[model samples]
Target: MCIFCKIAKKEIPAKLVLEDDDLVAFHDINAQAPIHVLVIPKQHITGIGEVTDEHVTVLGKLLVAARRIAEDAGLSQSGFRVVVNHGQHAGQTVHHLHVHVLGGRPLAWPPG
Candidate 1:
């Protein structure tokens, strides 16, 4: 199984921040900001390219969860950033579809 699948299965440990039927949010192992969380689907999905109409609900859930995570991390007032690295060229190290929620400091433009 993929690493995220393992995390979702509790086979791998993650600093879980939020979880529900559709997705889970956890702290990024290599945090880029004071509050950097990864929100991923419970089901295994390679990347955004693999997302289909069936994934619409779960995809929306990811954003909703990110918003909640940002609030819980105390970035709600200052605002936060959400990123989805779609492919290898885009710096997606892991194949699983995940959203990066980052905040708690000033983020520069031209992010990679």
Candidate 2:
């Protein structure tokens, strides 16, 4: 199983932030920002395109969840950024699709 799959299954420990039947959010072990959260689908999918219409509702909910997490993390007032690394070259280390909610400081442009 992939590390994220292990995390989803609770076979491995994660500093969980939010969780439900379809998705889970956790603090990245190697956080890039003060409030770096990784929101991932419970049902592992390789990438965004692999997600179907059946996933549309959950994807919407996921975005909502990210906002909620941002508010909970006190980033609502300051604003935040959301990111999804689509494939290997895009910087996705884990096979599971995920959204990254980050904030708590000034972020650079052109996220290279």
Candidate 3:
């Protein structure tokens, strides 16, 4: 199983922010921002490229969880960014589909 799958199954430990039957939000091991978190679906969907109609509900839940996490972390008013890296070129190290929530500082216009 993939590392993210292991996290969801409780085989691996993650700094979880939020969790439900559909998805989970956890702190990124390699944080890119002060308030960085990774929100992912419990079911392994590989990446955004693999998403189908059946994955819509869980995808929505993932985004919602991201927003909730950001608010809980006190980044809602300061603003936050949500990102999804689709492939290797996009900086996706994990195979599982996940959303990145970044905030707690001034973000540049052109993100690298």
For model 3, how does the per-residue alpha-carbon lDDT over 27-80 read when each residue is reduced to its tens digit? 999998999999989899999999999998998888888888888999988999
Residue range 1-112, candidate 1, lDDT tens digits: 8999899989999999999988988999999999899999999999999999999999999999998888888888899999999888999999999999999999988885
TM-scores for all candidates: the values are: 0.97, 0.96, 0.97
Off by over 4 Å in 1: none
By lDDT, the candidates rank as: 1, 3, 2
Worst 10 residues of 3 by lDDT: 59-68
Estimate every model's Cα lDDT from 0 to 1: 0.93, 0.91, 0.92
| Candidate 3 residue 4 C-alpha distance from true site, Å | 0.3
RMSD for all candidates, in order, please.
0.7, 0.9, 0.7
Better of 2 and 3 by TM-score: 3
Per-residue lDDT tens digits for candidate 2, residues 45-94, read: 88796988888988998899999999999998889999999877899888
Local lDDT at 100 for model 2: 96
